[model samples]
Target: MEFSGKLFIFLLLPLLQISTCDAYANPIYHACSKNFTSDNLIQDSINKTLSSLLAKTSLDSFGISSFGDGFFTIFGLSQCRGNLTVDQCAPCITKATEEIRTLCPNSAETRIWYDHCFLHYGTTKFFGEPDTSFTRVFSSGLIAADPIKFNYELMDLVYRMNAMTVGIDEKFSMYATHVSKNLSIFATAQCTRDLEELACRQCLDKLSEIFSGSCKYHLDCYVLSSSCVLRYAVSEFLNLPVSLSPLVFAAGFLAAGINSNLTGGHGFLPRSKADVMLNQLPEKSGSPENRELTAGHLSTWPVIGGLNHFVLVKFISGGLTAG
Candidate 1:
């Protein structure tokens, strides 16, 4: 999608969304095994593997390392968002290493996501592979005035980005365009650098399917997974040079009703224990009868500069959390 002329106007607004905050230390989501290692050798390998991966964060935005021999070997991978500078990426990874250790303690394998970076480690080799084992959906329940047209344009932007990311050396893409005079969208797609073209394509395709199905006409929506992430918002969430100004997007959006659903399956570690988060962040209620999250407790629209600026997020069936 080409840049829209009016799109430049929104760039002046201050970025207030939690997902786009500059402080990258805030944890977004994580998945870890309930099982902890009792062997000293295996625990040593995990520490070595994580330290090696953390060291590389200063050099580039992506790194993968394996430490130890035989079953004791620990494989680790770390990557910052595609647009981050070394200064921004390094500390995010550093904090992730510290936070994961504190949050999960001695789990054999774990994965953590911050706004600017992702870190994962396990005894098994998962490099160059696509994993959709766990999925989380965040949608702004605000429906578009013209749902059909908005979806057509949104898919166009997403598919074009997917094509570009897989074809490039850096498997990441972001863009912004005007859907209408009063409406604009900013989106991004990314895969771990360890993923080859085929693996990256596979991961992104799974995210696309979720976007096509559950995230149809919402003004803003994003699906997060272990291997890839697909997100689009009415406001600019990326770290582009331009600052978005507060604009009257649509009044009906502020009053939109919550639409929620539960898809049961806990990624790779489905039977793992209930997710352990810092400060015991609110999680989707674990009830067979109460399947939906009401706006009274779990749902909210955080206002920014007199505008309902943030996405309407739905916590899917997984250990999901927001910073």
Candidate 2:
């Protein structure tokens, strides 16, 4: 009886841990326009537009589609963070579409923001134009060690990253890491691919100004708009690649120290625990090529399984005319 109870505990514990580790991917905010109601034709058009976006978004992480004619026409766009794989991007967008439909219901114009993706659909055409009217600024809730010095460094880093991002081939994504006073700063600036280079730069610069105006003392902050997003953190929160990936060294090193705290010292396990388990797996006494293949698999498992957490502090201002 004692041995059976112990085995049961061992099996059940991992399952419980797995359940707790799954992060809740909910919409941070949503807005529905009371301007128009959707009839059957408009609703069908909306459905078709959303389906097209879901079908094509996985290719380059961006999709735009329009359907119907006259007042019933529906235009939609979906975009995912650049660092996410198609597997990750697809699900985030799928969930956004599902939730936005329920949240906004019959409203003809609506937008929703999730942790990894954003979706928008409406009767009005909004492509190519920058939408800075609806903005949200989030802070990490921790103040910088030196507000003045940190603000200067933060702005400089953001400007440099924006320049690099606008110049990237066609991907239109840029991330940069800066270390100051033993603190690491990870920043990513991105614009919708529909925008031209000048527009992207202007959109990011305007977001940077918004961040500087309101949250200059914050250790970490995010300025988000319908057309662009800028975020930076003291800890490595982004899953960028090693050459461009901010979390590689930080995840490998600080994960051990931080994971325990995140898990409350018991009951749950952090995503990096997968790496430790993979390393402990018994190796086959096989050829060098076989061993190399196993090693390659080991390196990628953590990225696939890892979970990231984000805390949002939203400040909503009055809406502006679309520019």
Candidate 3:
């Protein structure tokens, strides 16, 4: 018994050390643009831009700023996950800023993504446009027990949530959740606040295509782009509130004449013009707001670039599984 205990301790020690290392290494990925400069003026502008972004970390979870002029100008921005509290967001952004400085010290343009936030600085203007080029897909690597049934259900939930996210009348109506058959899925699809509703919807549609094409079998997955992000997980990774009400709201819109053809060709039933007009009638006073902010307070500043993160936790029940 003493020898068996000693062997067990030796085996478990390395796993504990790995977990501790992962906890402290939060950055998902980072990129430094091919553009480089030895000019001191450009470096000064980059420094000032990053400093300004770090200074406003407490005021809002998302913000953008520019420093310097002409060829030496730098545009910088930072955005935290919508569900994070201000207290959580500040430190996440601060850490991201420090990481980018260390990782891309001499690059004139750089972006870094972490579990809870993203930081970016560049010489070109990149606001209001959807950037699907730079993307990362993270998966749990554990296939579902019943891939066909699981994929169908997961896709259906994600499609419904996508519809609800775009139709609501909020500055950032980009989050939704659903629960079915002992499985609960939380999803969020968001774009920079500067985007129009149609533009945001289009960006999310592209993300859905990437997810369906590549990550359909994984239990939890995330698709992160430069301009938008889509994430779904069995575990409750987001700090936002979850209400089972969005399903009903989306159904009502479907019953109306709203277009059923979303970007990725997933949609609800279409209705007649008369039904749509009737649904548009004004409601009585004291009606609930058209939108709900499940996440923390909305950020007033415009966001430039963003990404999403996924954390996998495994379990076993006569077989290997994860959620």
Candidate 4:
């Protein structure tokens, strides 16, 4: 069931009311569950796998090696923000390993992002290729006061970050930082190093598009995946002076859809009839300037013998000024 924008906020109270709780909504989750290696059983050999991969890792190389007795091909990847070091990346991996399962619950695989790092694992080969369906997008109610200026500063920062990625030793990540005219932005993009540079850039380009699709107006937002994360915010979310380069490669995007609101800034629904209810945006690149913001949260339940799921999203408005 869906809720009217007004009813949703009053129910939430005390806050802007942007809470999201998703089930294992991924088709990949279903496929993995059908072949899940019971967690109780994994306890026996997971230690051996962890020990071997941890033995020979270095600053530039986070290599995956086989474990004791050669029974499993264990691959683990640890990606901290591009500017981080062993001191940061190492421990982040340890904590993320424990925390992600708790967040996702009983799913055979999971991915979680901390401000400093991200982690993911599976029994299958996920070392290469970009997977779009395995993703989630979230944003807060706040928006940068001047998105045009924000976008200008952000573009320069990400371009530098892309350059740094281009000079990598075949291990790739996309990242950038720009503190322009007091509108600071820091963002990062990364992928498994095993992927060829072309594929890595392509994967990251897909994420860049996803970031713009989901949170371009947020001023403080991030999109994370097991493979990479794209982030940009107007505040100093991290405490490092980033020095990365822009991509000297090709990474194109597939077809995309965008949602914009006229009331300063609002949430973009990948699918919605709200766009139907409102006046249309101009064919040019500008957004509307005097409308309402719609933010929302969702909860879901399974139905139809696992073939269908029922979802309930409650949308809230920050302000409903009349045009």
lDDT per residue for candidate 4 within 97-152, as digits (tens), equals 55544554444344455555554544555676655445545555566787777666
TM-score of 1: 0.68
User: On residues 28-109, what C-alpha lDDT tens digit does candidate 2 reach at each position?
Assistant: 5577774545479889988999999988886767999999999889998999865566777888888888888888888788
Residue-level error in angstroms, candidate 1, position 63: 0.5
* Candidates in descending lDDT order: 1, 2, 3, 4
**Model 3: residues with Cα > 4 Å off, grouped in runs:** 1-25, 35-37, 167-180, 239-323
Q: Identify the leading candidate in terms of lDDT.
A: 1
Off by over 4 Å in 2: 1-24, 169-174, 240-323
Cα error, residue 183 of model 3, in Å, equals: 2.3
319 Cα displacement, candidate 2 (Å): 48
Error of 1 at 311 (Å): 26
Better of 2 and 4 by lDDT: 2
- Residues 177-286 of candidate 1: C-alpha lDDT, one tens digit per residue: 56888887778888998888889999999889888878888777767677888877877676442323211111111112111121211100000111111113333333
Write the candidate numbers in order of decreasing TM-score. 1, 2, 3, 4
Supply the TM-score for candidate 4. 0.53
Please count the clashing residue pairs in each candidate, in the order shown.
10, 2, 0, 12
